[model samples]
Target: MVSLSGSWLANGGGIWMLAAFYGATAAYGIHVGDRSSEVVESTRDVGDAAANFAGFKISTVNLSGQNHVSPGEILATAGVKPTSSLPFLDAEAARMRLEEMAWIKRATVQKFYPDRLDIQVVERQGYALWQKDGKINVIARDGTVIAPYSDDPRYVKLPIVVGEGAEAHVVEIVEALDLVPGVRDQVRAAIRVADRRWTLKLRNGIDVRLPETGLDGALASLAVFDRDKSLLSRDITVVDLRLADRVTVRLSDAAYEARQADLKARAKAKKGSNT
Candidate 1:
């Protein structure tokens, strides 16, 4: 009985050693096969071997969270197609192509096993239209120029700003406008000149010329005058607040004549009353 037990243990140990040897051989074979397949696939031209790729098959195309870009468009732009080989697929190239689109701010691409590609994208957030050099352009919140100028009516409500260095000074203008009461709402356009002075065109076609120096003071004074006197409602064409102390106004010719005549009539009535 002792001899029989020893023989059984030896047989079991031999079987285990054989199984481990076979498993190691199988793993090495797989590694070699993968390396050889990669070499052959890398040497082959994808464009020329289109018919060979047809056999692998694309099981899934996952573009679930895409908002700005169409899935079909994304696939076409990435040059990804049905039955594309996992080893030959270029995820970085696909991602770069999608990033070229104006609406897509960033894109990430990944490959899933068997036959699936995953794509994720972030779209640009359009903030406002920037006008410069007689052209209107769309700008993002970070002040990046998104698109070129166009006369499209969709952007008609955007404020028109002009003059040298307007693009760099846009944030400052927005800040300044916010400080002035009612000026931001009534402003149709803000023009910046080469000298860095600002001129604002109101919705009512009235121009407010800000001072090259002491602009904040001028804006404050204008705010006070408007609040107390409703100066904007008057028949004034232009308000020149360039000087420090005085506010000069350019009145329409008709209104100016009427005001002068009224003054003279008042004086005549006073003299007659005195007599």
Candidate 2:
């Protein structure tokens, strides 16, 4: 039973007056199916009235774990009006709608009684910058494209990955170089070469050729060589680790000439010692 009070009524209309108003709305001739339909409608209306009287109208909307995406956008996507009823809200559908946004990697929408709705969201993290067709995009760890990179200062410092298949294999490239952060930090870009192998362009303009197979071993060997010989700092143009058994370092023209002169001098000194 619901008690009718003048103060509790909306727009200064009492429940007794409103109920009477609806009661006198129309004259209904007694029919077989009409009575059942009217009873069902009346029952539904009473339930809605009870719910409204008990303060089930939406009053609070709480949001947490949101970043990158604003709360206003989420609420708009949810389509829940300020006076929406908690009973009619589809939490799962609202959650799916919220997750449709690119920035929202995952989300949860829940409606509480006594007029409140809550949203929880987990935003995607920017992993690297992917360049394709001269357009750069911020990519997530799993290669999901977040948004187009357009002079965004936040993503300016991320590692640049290029080529069509680079996004999918970028995780492996980063993982292989994880053990060599010192050298990895100096990497300007990681390019997928011929859609088969990877070539790392170093900050100093040296192109490090990585092998198609046994990448871990090749990277490990490079790490060891770099640590032992300060290989990256030398006047080397290319560091080829394509062959599993040998390391090939291509020198600049000047360095190659200097190396040839030093080898000839050593050969001559050896011949002199023998003579």
Candidate 3:
């Protein structure tokens, strides 16, 4: 029961007093139902209108912790209508609705008594870019797809994973790559082949084929080869590490011909020296 003071009674006049009384009674009878939703909605609109006329309308909004999502999106998701009054706004319900958005990790909605609404949102971070079926998306750290790729400058430098099921197991490969920065730094994309093993595409167009088993050891060996023999800098097309026994490197066509010519020249020199 809302007990109005003498001063409020004097200021509200007869029409405002009657509306406020009816609104208060309607508020008390509010309930959730599919059949009576229209009735409830009308009553809510009436109550909020009356309360708004009494200067309880939500006129100001304070929003924070939002970087990627726009303020309008949050307000719309929260169902903050133009005629919504502080007393009628369901803060907890609004918060749950806000969190349904992909970017919003969590959200808090608060209504101040007179005329203010406050919203705080913790947004999810874009961890990597995932490409599949000719579409690219920004994915969260846990591999949840946040949104379709828009070439957003913020996520341009993120590591890329390609294939159908790569998003689900991206964390494992990403963590393994992190352990070997020497190879990781040069990786352009981690392509999931047959949804089984990963083939890393380097920035220089070199494909590093990793074994289905012993992934870490293969990457470590590749790093050592790069460090000692400057293998990565050489004119190589593919570095096949699928076989545990050896690292098979396929040289570029030009490099292969150059190597063959050098071997022949050495052989001819030896034959001439014998003469």
Top-lDDT candidate index: 3
Model 2, 1-275: lDDT tens per residue? 11122333233445664454334233221222365766644543443454444445455678888878777787778766543445545689789998888888899987767566788899898888998889889998888898989677888988888998989887888887777787788899999887788999999999999999988888888888888999989999999999988999999999999999999999999999999
> How far in Å is the alpha carbon of 51 misplaced in model 2?
7.9
How many clashes in each structure? Answer: 0, 0, 0
- Superior candidate under TM-score, 1 versus 2: 2
Using Cα atoms with residue i matched to residue i, what is each candidate's TM-score against the true structure? 0.61, 0.74, 0.79
Q: What is candidate 3's lDDT per residue for 83-159, written digit by digit as tens?
A: 67677777998999988899999998877777778899999999899999999999998788889988678989989
Tens digits of per-residue lDDT for model 1, 63-134: 755654677778778766543444345689789998888767888988766455678888775555777666
Clashing pairs in 1: none
Task: Choose 2 or 3, whichever is better by lDDT.
Answer: 3
TM-score ranking, high to low: 3, 2, 1
- Model 1 stretches astray by more than 4 angstroms: 1-59, 64-68, 82-86, 132-135, 143-157, 163-165, 179-181, 211-221, 241-246, 262-275
Most accurate candidate by TM-score: 3
TM-score of 3: 0.79
**TM-score of candidate 2 relative to the true fold:** 0.74
- lDDT at residue 39 of model 3 (Cα atoms): 75
